[model samples]
Target: MSVIPAELDGAVIPGGCADCNAEQHFRQDEPGMWFIGIAHDDWCPTWRRIQAQRAGLPTTFLS
Candidate 1:
């Protein structure tokens, strides 16, 4: 269960983690991990798995 930290409420960074600073997340192995006082899910794992499972289907794209 990942919840946005109170300190990062309303924080915004283009191309970076929506919940934390982008510069802090440097580990390539877990690119989806965001540095918000801890390794938080910038992109939720369940959603990532779902996206992976649906990969290569034309419906995955949007018009």
Candidate 2:
């Protein structure tokens, strides 16, 4: 579950994890738009790929 208000425009990352459920929260402030956090299971492959991509590492998943 997210603490962010539902009225705020946001995006969802779908996955099969029962825990995290692969949701991302975003909010706009003085600094501009930013994601509050990423919710994903530790063992989720999608999360792994995302982390790899963010770290500038290559991933087997195709865009």
Candidate 3:
């Protein structure tokens, strides 16, 4: 599951192991709509609130 709201406007689609949190892109090519996952890069899946006492980022509503 995603920690941030799925509606995040500026956030490009992410990829890789759910724990890896690496953001990747799906290029339009011979593979059709298949997504290529990136690893060891800039991924921010830390925003998720793990428990009650902990806090999560405010949900961002997109237009």
Query: Scored by CA lDDT, what does every candidate get?
Result: 0.44, 0.62, 0.44
- In model 1, where do residues sit more than 4 Å from their true spots? 1-42, 56-63
Clashing pairs in 3: none
RMSD (CA, Å), each prediction: 12.9, 8.0, 13.5
Output the lDDT of residue 61, model 1.
Answer: 75
| Top candidate (TM-score) | 2
lDDT tens per residue, model 3, 25-60: 444333233334354333435423233225544456
lDDT of 2 by residue, 1-63 (tens): 435555564655464455556766555452444556668878878788778879884556646
lDDT score, candidate 2: 0.62
Candidate scoring better on lDDT of 2 and 3: 2
Deviation (Å) of 56 in candidate 1: 5.1
Q: Please identify which of the two predictions, 2 or 3, would achieve the higher TM-score against the true structure.
A: 2
> If both were scored by lDDT, which would come out higher, candidate 1 or candidate 2?
2
- Residue 6 in candidate 3, Cα distance off native in Å: 19
List, residue by residue over 1-63, the lDDT tens digit for candidate 1.
335444443344333335543332222223334443234355756445556777855765756
After superposition on all CA atoms, how large is the RMSD of candidate 2? Answer: 8.0
Enumerate residue pairs that collide in model 2: none
- Model 2, poorest ten-residue lDDT window? 25-34
By lDDT, who's the top model here? Answer: 2
